[model samples]
Target chain A: MSSPLAKPQIIAHIQKSLNYTVFDSKWIPCSAKFVCLGNFARGTGVMQIYEVQHGEAQLVKEVEKPKPIKCGTYGATSLQQRHIATGDFDGNLNIWNLESPEVAVYSAKAHKEIINCIDGVGGLGIGDGAPEIATGSRDGTVKIWDPRQRDTPVANMEPIEGETKRDCWTVAFGHAFNDQDRCVCAGYDNGDIKLFDLRNMSLRWETNIKNGVCCVEFDRKDINMNKLVATSLEGKFHVFDLRTQHSTKGFASVSEKAHKSTIWQVKHLPQNRDIFMTAGGAGNLHLWKYEYPAQRSKKDSDGVDVGVAGTVNLLQNVTLSTQPIASLDWSPDKQGLCVCSSFDQCVRVLIVTKLNVV
Target chain B: MTAEEFVSLQNQGAVIDYNGKVPVEHLDYGYIEKCKDVKYLEKILKVLRSGEEGIYPDLISFCETRLELLDPKNRLLITDKPVTTAASLSKDEWGQIVDDLKMWQEESKKTEDSLKHQPLLNDIIKENIPPIRGSNQSVDIQQKQNKNHCKRPLPRDYQEWDKFDVEKECEQIDSNSSTTSDTPAIVNTGLSKLRTTLDASFLAEREQLNLATREKDKGNEAFRAKDYEEAIAYYSRSISILPTIIAHNNRAQAEIKLKHWNNAMKDCQRVLKMEPGNIKALLRRATVYTNTGRFETAAEDLRTVLKQEPQNPAALKLLSETELKLQDEGMIKKKRKGKKILIEEVDGDDGHNEKRQGGLKGEIFWVLYIINHLSHNLYNT
Candidate 1:
């Protein structure tokens, strides 16, 4: 076969030994610094900030916590603040100001069970909306909290009485640009995907993927609604077209098998809307691109308009270690630079080149 | 539904009466008022849909009432619906829309089935897409291939490769010309060329070594004369021709005399990369680190040197000096923290009594006394 037009090159720049099970890693916006949250051998969580200097990951600060941190994000705060919001195993949500590492600037008891996932939106001064945080918990609830309000959630979605509660696995905020028309997409262990419109206070849409949804993310948060990707436990992920909504059929989606094992997490490149990366339970990372259709919607046999979904093309795949990659985050400032934490007790800094070709 | 039927249904609490209509007396006043208000909106919408002008006052009132009704509670319920201004599309335009819709559906179906049997696309499409190269494949493959090719045996005898012998060919040409030409001028130029060629070949190794040694000697003479700049130039010339440990060492010494710490450090680092156990390079780099305020790195280098030669007095003294510098830095940091705490405590007491001037003086004295005591303890340690 002939070679492709533009092939990406993945360079493993640095690999640092954390000596602990790393759960999550995130890059600070507009900076070359990143924070890795892990659990030490003595059962304490540690958040360490490292700066990239001359191709070396130099440890700048380390903060120890009483509980294991499950996830973290800086998407809820401004770049100037550089506050890291983290959800721990104890269901407590804490936002730490890196400048003052002694205590959490904001702490709230968020859930009755372990907080499975956390995502933030409208921060970094990108949109006109107020900064909000969404937390998905094992208590079968997804709550949206405006950071300006302390100890209370602005909107909460819980299973109705007598309905069996399932573990809410992941939550993400989307469509929060311009005018505060925001939506929260949450995935549950029961293969349920719910998109709740924050502006209307209603369930915009819901579907069952028939497998435990591990992660769900929108292509971009600034647009009204473009695309939503949800990965499940059976090595399959579905990308839904959100532009056209049918009264009976909802959004059109296409499912593809990936990872050959449970897909753990998926992160879209901050620089390109079409490119994304998925971390697998079998210790593999795959780069993919979503090819858009020429037309976004079509009229069905019943004369009802239906949405058209794009296809995913796998560009690259590499196995970095034998353990599952727990989390991966792309740098917002740099095009193809990313940092990932795996179950192998190590954090790796990777550079993916030739992204501009796509 | 017609407007009157819609109003009748709404008035009946969204239910139809047994007689297919509601009694007039059972009608809600608010429902009647809302229905009457919506008639004006319906008329304005009809006019707008017809694409007519004039009746600006009616349109303005219609919009004002709609906004007032949707202002507070039903604000989010407002949606932008597509209002058809034109009557209908032409037959060609309708055909085009249908064709586009069909094409879009087909495209969507194709993508939906692209990954039916495999997690990734099939080999044909996958091959069409570019393959991302891993870090292992990013190095120069041509250079590696050339190296491998050089390591392999040639097809014929090495001496039989006449095309590779350019110098030998030049020599043969010179010899032939010298034999053919009998004129003195021609012979002189040819002989000069031959002599230059011979000199070039001879100087390739033996003569260059001698010249480099002479330059080193010149550097030593300049160094003894205290002309450090001239000495450095001579040493650089010797090293550029043929680098030697002595020349680099002398150049580094000259750079030190000039207080060019960075240049001296680079020379020392180059020497260390070549000879890991060179004591002079290690000592020079350690001194450079100390001068640059990198006490920790200096102490590390000094300790490494001491490990090799325990009785080295210079290493031991420099190690102690680095230790003292590190302790002083720590003392300063602790003093700042202590002073901050003392000031906070004094401020808190002052908040209770602003007139406590004597108490403030006493607090200041205690802060100074504690800082001095802490510094003394740190130095003793």
Candidate 2:
């Protein structure tokens, strides 16, 4: 498989001495709107949502959180409703409705330490009602919550060994492919990745990398395959093939030291299953493509596993900033369009030429 | 020279007349070369060799120089003349000839200079020197060294001359006559008008430039306001009057904002094509590259920008970003080990940092703080 080569072009530039520093951002799926959060230095809350327009991005709404917001996500559902969920430094998780332009739909202090990551997927494990949100934090715990019950979490997953806790940096979930319960993946500072099967409330699998894992992402668009990508502090990226039982059969290294500093975030392209983008601590965003090698025979020769694909190649790379890029999300309508927030006090839109790769 | 040639030249209003003849004795070398007719050359020689005892010594010397031209073996040709020469003769012989000619020329000058006081001498001479003819008519020579010696004969018609004398006497009696009153005024006004016309054309050219500058500034201000349509209107108006690069760049920026990508690209390409090394055009093209998803190309533009201005913040930022995106793990590791890559990079800005003093404040302060903290060592040596 050959890596896809893409060219990145900057669309617009805005220079303002913003009151707060950007920590994370998310594109509202299927819409031109997105939300970002940081500290609004003059005593206002950290999270703000800006609507992209023809002239410039405008501050459409701002939500007050208990502490600095580290990450944010949007649930897969309606576009016009403006449902946004955010995790803050104080370990408080909040979801807001931007449709009214100003209303907090859900709020709770969910963790004892800084909340590192938050994600949501509706109409599945929640029994076809409201969307369920998941948050991971430095307190070494992952919590699943439904907005209806504002106080206690629906379920919580902690490490089984009870060893000294490592900060949980990111969390992701996807519905099982063959009548299995939904699995949650959490990445920690100790370079360990833990997956939890919510149906049995038991540990599913664990893997150790050489560096602290900063972000984790499941290929949400891939309905038939079990693939997960993770980015670590040392700029190492890992892709797992969870379809088979062999622990080592599915893993592939995308690249190592791809960024100068920490790898802050990784996201699967919303429309393309084999495409993804990663953010760096040094303020750059790189887009990548993974392709499965062509098979030669009905029965493959690799002895360990029958369905394992060998190596992955990086296709396109783009730098969206000069300061550390903390988070990134792709535009739902455009296959190659992605947005990133950086320490440079700006959000940039990058366009890629080729996202659909074999 | 023919009288008709002089008449024709005068009719065409030629300021400097070439056909006009100068006195044979006073002709300089420059005019002699301009007279190319061989027939007139013979006539001049005949006139020179036929000189009587009272012929001017100046004319005789002029004839001798022309005579030497006949001897090709002597490196001089006939009809070729010299205005002045120093022959290596014994002192007594050359000194006597020089003394005699010097005296004659001085006597002729005195007579000419006093013609205003003794008008009879002007009549006796008709002209101080004899007229030259045909190809030997060297008027430019007379103008160069002997213009003052060439006397023009006063109007020879005796009746008309007497009438001019009588009119002058009458003007003294009736000083209020209209002709007398208006003559000086017309002469003075004509002189002043000529001077003004010469100066006005130069001033007009400068004023045109000033007007163009004012119009351009108006257009530039409109561009700064982000009203691209209005700005374009103003820019077009200014460009029609006088085109400039600043206006072109402004129009290109506005076009990009309107998503007229091709138009913007063409404008930038035009500017750079006209002036390939223009800093502004290069920067504008760099931005266009970024927008078009040509990050590698954009990096080349930024590199050029940096070479010209080493501390250019925009170029540096863009360059670092592009490098980060281009990071392949193997390549990064190879580059880190300092292997020379064959990438053809663009020239960056020169080493002059514009905000050198101002930018160093934060970075320098941090460095100093670290040094101060380190000075207080936990382990006392």
Candidate 3:
């Protein structure tokens, strides 16, 4: 792997023991620092700043709150600000400045229950749109926040009156090709995945994957809708080609059972969107690369254009932990460098060698 | 054919070079002046790892020194001698070791104030340490070298601290501050109310018990998978939250698998302390005693188990083995020492073998169900 002739190697580089249940980990953009969000045994939410220097993760800052944090994202804020927006068990959304995390820079009562997942886009110059954060919560609502407009979310997708509320598990933003062309995709516990167009304020696409959806991610958030991958409570994960949507069929998809247990997460490489990784409940990480189908769009029986599903090739697989790996984040500054947190209360820094060659 | 298709390479000004993409934050000329955020500066330090010896030489180093003088921990000093940077951090780094070293230094300083004697100063003075290594070496080679022996901070007065009762200390601190405060009465009332509000934790005592049981179940899962270390950790967590006899017994059984004789004995003793008549605990403790060459204690535990249940084959088999061991030591009279125990004479003596292939990784644990006879070979998941 070092010489690039061998297969990509997933090496567990460094591991730091944490005293809390880390629900999420994310790399700070253009930097070596990464943030860990989790709750202590006594249920106090903790945000820790770990700067990776010389293959070591240094805990530079730490802050505690009354509520346990479940999810966090750096997508909504620019590198200069480098603010971390988090969702806690109390269903409150907070953006914090790492320097002084005693109080949130921005806070809002996002939901009635816990916010399970969150994503941010239009920041750091990746996408051409207003910087925004999307949060999916146990309250069965997916909301989008523009930090400039504090107190309330700019957009909220919720269950209709009299309809049963399905807990929202994950959410992501994509299709930000221009200033006003962004979209948010949300996954629910009822196996339903919904993509809401922010510009139109309507559902662009929705599908059910037979099990509670655990995660939904777009390969690239800055471009027009290209591809999306959704993992579920079961071992199944589906990749949808979003470039074309038929009149009847939403988007062509290819499903694969990658893990023996729940598929916890899927992270697309920041530099190469074609390459991605899936973390399994059995503590295994499966690196995959998506091969575009020979044709992206084809005519259906009634002559309507339908999308073609791509084939996902398993590039590499490594079991670096024993417990379920809860979360993993790829670093933006360097390729193949990533951080993963497991149920065992340890955060391991892993380097996937030979990713660029693949 | 190759020459016919050749074309001159031209630089396309229209294309945005993704490789050279600079962050939007760096575009601002007044960023350094406006950027008061410490995290952002940390990132910049990462990008330019050697700001200490930059193009402008002392410009970056001057500011960094002032920053470190501002905060000692931020300086990331490798030893007593102050180093400006973690040495061009472009190699295999260890964050936890550095943090632990800093903590040890603080601890040493506190001790230094209490006692004017310094113990480790000689070692520190003798050891010629390089704060940073060259970044040219490949990571793999550096990691191998690090494994052999690497730089770690050793304070002048380092000693192992005694075990602390974290929960007791926390409670003591809480009570001490509240009693001294003007609103001591309100603080007492506030805790009970807060319990009802924070449903993120167990609602009541019953719920906490249930949570502990759930953790025990998780420990059982790890044990069934033959992950003894993780099982011990989970069982320890369960005990810290709420101790249960079953959790203790299961922990002992798991400890026995890992040959943690002392820990297994301790867990068994804890269980026996709570329930003297606990058949499972007695049998597990006997197993530990036999393994640790305590035949007398093992025979006693086995005798107690046989007294409780005459038809218990596992205990009977273990007792027979212990009796032979004792007889060999000339300590106890063994009536069945010479008799070869036939498997047909004892029912369920085959040692309850269960192959659990349920859920993602099934068959956690049951106190009454699977016992520790499978000590020879724990079924691999």
Top TM-score hit: 3
In angstroms, give how far residue A278 of model 2 lies from its true place. 1.5
In the predicted model 1, the residue pairs found to clash are: none
Candidate order by decreasing lDDT: 3, 1, 2
TM-score of each: 0.49, 0.44, 0.49
Distance (Å) between predicted and true CA of A355, model 1?
0.4
By DockQ, is 1 or 2 better?
1
Among all windows of 10 consecutive residues in model 2 chain B, the one with the lowest summed lDDT is: B134-143
Once fitted onto the true fold, the runs of candidate 2 whose alpha carbons sit more than 4 angstroms away are A1-17, A42-44, A76-80, A101-103, A123-130, A160-162, A176-180, A221-225, A247-255, A295-307, A356-358, B1-381
The best-first sequence of candidates by TM-score reads 3, 1, 2
lDDT of 1 at B199: 16
Fold similarity of candidate 2's chain A to the true chain A, as a TM-score: 0.85
Give the per-residue lDDT digits (tens) of candidate 3, residues A106-199: 9999889999999998665455556788888887888877777767777778876677889989999987645567788888888998888777
Error at B357, model 1, angstroms = 99
Error of 3 at B79 (Å): 45
Evaluation by lDDT, superior candidate among 2 and 3 = 3
Listed per prediction, chain B TM-scores read 0.35, 0.31, 0.35
